[model samples]
Structures are given as structure tokens and as C-alpha cells.
Target: MDERELRNCFGKFPTGVTIVSWFDGSVQKGITVNSFTSVSLDPPLALVSIHKEAKACTGMKDKAFTINILSDEQESIAWQFAGSKQEILEIDWDNKGISPKINGSVAWMECKPWREYDAGDHVLFVGEIQELHFEDLEALTFYQGKMGSAKQLVK
Candidate 1:
């Protein structure tokens, strides 16, 4: 199987960008992900697929986490977490919650670990949402390996 080709094929679908943040002892850690999705409403469960090799994959196990859905203005933040940029950007975090959330996200969900599944190259983490927040701002999105705003893609 051609991994690059498979990734390209998967990239055809648009996905909302997110920063999955968690605490590693006293330090905060996060990773860029576009594979977040709501798994259930009655149980208020959400899921994030993280590559097995990512630090966040192990750091978040059995830990509280926040899925910070990026706003359209947060492209640089995504790059920073994705390890594509060298310069570290100063990010403001809302630390009042069980897990700190990135400020200025279009939406955020604070969650507790629920379950984990071993997928091929990634691990699927199911989180039970304990709290959430949202704003009426445009979301950052990924499609065809490019980043853009939800509004920009709709047009």
C-alpha cells in the first residue's frame, strides 16, 4: 500500500482542526489533530484519533483532556502543534477547567477518559465530555492537504 497516496485520498474529506491538550504530570502537552468527532450525544462522548507515535497518544491515556476546536484565525497554532514550525508561539490557555483549553477556539470540550481502541497506525480515544463551550466564530479546516476557514470552503 502506498501510504502517501492513501493519505492523499483521505485528505479529500474536509475535517475540523483541533488541538488535543492534556497534562503530563505538571506540564501541559498538545498535538494537532483533524480526526476529532462526536461519538455519542446521550453519553456526550467525543473521539480523537492520534498517531501511535505522538507524545499526546501516551500522555493522554486515562487523563482528562480538552479538544480545542481551532478558529479560522489559529492557523499558526495548528502548525506549531503539528511540529511544522520552528518558532514557538505564545498561546493563551483557559486553565479553570479540569484540562486547560486553548483560548480563542471556535469550540472546546473538556473530557475524561472513557475508552481506547487500537486502530492500525493510530489509537482511537473516546472521551466523555464533562463540559463544553462554543463561540459563533468560523472554524479552521483541512482539505486536500491545505488549511482554510469553514466559511472560505463553503464558497
Candidate 2:
């Protein structure tokens, strides 16, 4: 199998969209990430995997980061961060937590750095969830190389 074939196969799995954000001393840095998940509720842990070359990865060295679960209406915000160059974050950022978080997201998890691992070209940044909040809004998701919205089907 080739790279595109692998990526296409990976795209088949639906993933929630999250903006992994952190502060690099003086400024905020972040990236659009679909690679985030809850690790363990016992310890209240979670993970957000970012590319090794992403600024947010290196900037997170000794700081805190936030996992902002994007809502369906925040598709434009996703595109803005995932764009080629780091577009200046023009959104209202809330500082009531460990790291800067976007306003109006479906949910937010403020985490302190827990651990990190090398996962191929990505750096898995695990965090201990220090604070969390959620709303009843729908979530943004990615699947089959497209962005979409998802609502809890069982609830």
C-alpha cells in the first residue's frame, strides 16, 4: 500500500475535530487536530497527537495546552488553523483555564502536560485534564476526507 492509500484508509474512521492549543511563553499556538481522545477517566487523562513538525508540538514543551472540541458551526475556524500559514487567530479567546481556549466550542478541556511520545511523524501529547466544560451543541467531525457534523445518536 502507498501513502495515499494509507491516508484514505485512515480517513474512513470518523474522528472528532479538536483545536490543540498551548502557550509558548508569550503567545498562543495551536493546530487543527483530529487525533484526540480520552485516555483514562480514573486519572482523568487525554491525548492530542500532533505532527512532530507542528509548532504547537514544540511550543508545548513545558507549558499547558487545551483541547477545544469544535462545534459544527466552527468549521471555518478549523480551516483557518489548518491553512498553510498560521493565520492570526482572530477569535475571542477565553483565559479562564490552563491555556487559551476558543469561545463557543462544543467543549473544552484544559490540561497540564503529562507525558509525550514519539508516534512516527506525530508527537502524542498526553495531558491530565485539569478542567472541563461541555455544551449540548453538535460536534464537528472528519471522515472520508471531508468535514461534517455529528450528534449523539444514542442520546
Candidate 3:
């Protein structure tokens, strides 16, 4: 299989940028992900797919985590967590809860670990949403290997 070609094909679909954050003991950790989605409404479940080798993959198990949907203006924040060499950002994190919440995200979901499954190259982490919040703001998006702002298709 042409792995690069497959990734290119998958990249054609636009996805919202997100940061999956959790705490390892007293240290805060996060990873940039675009593969976040709601799984169920009755139980209020959410999912974030993390690469099997990602540091967060091991640290996030059995822990509370937050899925922070980035605002369009937060591209730098996304890059910072994605391991870019840019200057470290003075991130404002709300630590009153079990997990840290990135301030200024368009939306955020605080979740308790529900289950995890070994996917092909990623581990699917499903969480039960305990609390969620959102703000009215344009979202950051990724498509075709580039980052951009989402377009408003309707009022």
C-alpha cells in the first residue's frame, strides 16, 4: 500500500484542529489532533485518536482529559503542542479541574476515560463527557496538508 498516497487522500477532508490535554501526575501534557469526534449523545461520549507512539498515548490512560477545539486565531497554539520549533507559548491553562483547559478555545470538553482500543496505527481513546463548553468563534481547520480558517457557508 502507498502509505503516503493514502494519507494524502485522507487529508482531502477538512478537520477541525484540537488539542487533547491531560496531566501526568503533576505535569501537564498535550498533543495536537484533528481526529476528534462525538461518539454518542445518550452517554455523552467523545473520542480522540492518538498515534500509538505519541507520548500522550501512554500518559492519558485512566485520566481525565480535555478536548480543546481551537479557535481560528489559535493556530500558533496548535503548532506549539504539535512539536513545532516556534517559541514556547505562555499558555493559559485552567487547572481547577482534573485536566487543564486551554483558555480561548472555541469549545472544550472535559472527559473521564471510558475505554481505549488498539487501532491500526493509532489508539482510539473514548471518553465520557462530564462537562462541555463552547464560545462563539471561528474554528481553526486543516485540509490538504495546510492549516486555515473555516469558512461560513450559511448564516
Candidate 4:
């Protein structure tokens, strides 16, 4: 299949939105990513795939990063980090004394890089979860190039 077909097929699967934040001195850099997942429970490992062209990709090396899992109410926050805006001054953000985190997110996971692999169009960053937090809110989801909420799939 062509690249367009491949992307379309990939988009068929829905995924949660997350903001991966890292520190550049006092300044914080973050990017919205849907390509994130748990790798292992015993080691508490997770991974995020970032495009080679992303500016935030290079800044993450050897630095602590926080994955702020967006709630359904955080579509604007996701769009902000997704590069929809030239500036994200309106978003409520804090460093949480560890790493940058978006306020009011459903969950947050602070991690340190464990490994990085070159994956052609993207780099896969594996991280060891350092800290985590959760709130009682529904998560935001991305599917077919649009934002929405996850619907429970009861079997």
C-alpha cells in the first residue's frame, strides 16, 4: 500500500492523546502524541513514538519527561501541543516540581528515558515510569484525524 493508504489504515485504530513534556532550563517543551503505550509492567516501562521532524524529539534525550494524559475536557490542550497554535499561552500548565504537566489532565506519568531506537520515520523512546497520577475523568481520544471521547466497548 502507498503511504496515504498506510496512514489511513493506521488511523482506523483509535488512540489516546498525551502531552510529553521535557525541560529546557526553566523553559518547558512539549508535544502532543497519540503513539504511546505501555511496554512492560514489571519494569513499569512505556514508550512514545515521535517523528524525526518534531522539535521536541531532540530535547528529550537524557531528560525527564512527563506524559500528561489528556481528559475529554482537554482537547484544547492537545491542540495546543499538536502545533495548531503558534503559542500556547492560554493553556494552564505547571512544572509540578518534577516536570511540566498540564493542569486538569486525567492522568500524568513522569518518566526518565531508558532507551531510544531509530524507527525510520520516527524515533521510539522507551521510558521508565518515575511517578504517576490519575484523576476521575474520561480520557480524550483520536480517531480518523478527529478528536473525541472513548466509548466503552463492552463485550
Instruction: Report the number of the highest-lDDT candidate.
Output: 1
Candidate 3 on 1-155: residue-level lDDT in tens?
99999999999788999999998887779999999999999999999999988888888888999999999888898998899945866888888687889999999999999999999989999999998899999999988877768673211
Q: Per-model C-alpha lDDT, please?
A: 0.92, 0.84, 0.90, 0.87
Report the C-alpha lDDT of model 1 over 1-155, residue by residue, as the tens digit.
Answer: 99999999998889999999988776778999999999999999999999999978888889999999999999999999999874767899888768989999999999999999999989999999999999999999998888889677745
| Model 4 spans with C-alpha error above 4 angstroms | 86-89, 151-155
Give candidate 2's TM-score.
Answer: 0.89
Candidate 2 regions exceeding 4 Å error are 84-89, 151-155
TM-score-superior candidate, 2 or 4: 4
Candidate 1 achieves a global lDDT of 0.92
Which residue pairs clash within candidate 3? none
Q: List the residue pairs that clash in candidate 1.
A: none
The predicted structure with the larger TM-score, 2 or 3, is 3
**TM-score, one value per model:** 0.94, 0.89, 0.94, 0.91
- Full candidate order by TM-score, most accurate first: 3, 1, 4, 2
Per-candidate clash tally: 0, 0, 0, 0
Question: What TM-score, to 2 decimals, does candidate 3 have?
Answer: 0.94
Q: How would you order the candidates by lDDT, starting with the best?
A: 1, 3, 4, 2
Residue range 19-127, candidate 2, lDDT tens digits: 8887766576778999898999989999988888876777787678899999988887888878745356467788766798998999999999899999999988889
The deviation in Å at residue 29 for candidate 1 is 0.7
Evaluation by lDDT, superior candidate among 1 and 2: 1
Instruction: Give the distance in Å from residue 34's predicted Cα in candidate 2 to where it truly belongs.
Output: 0.1
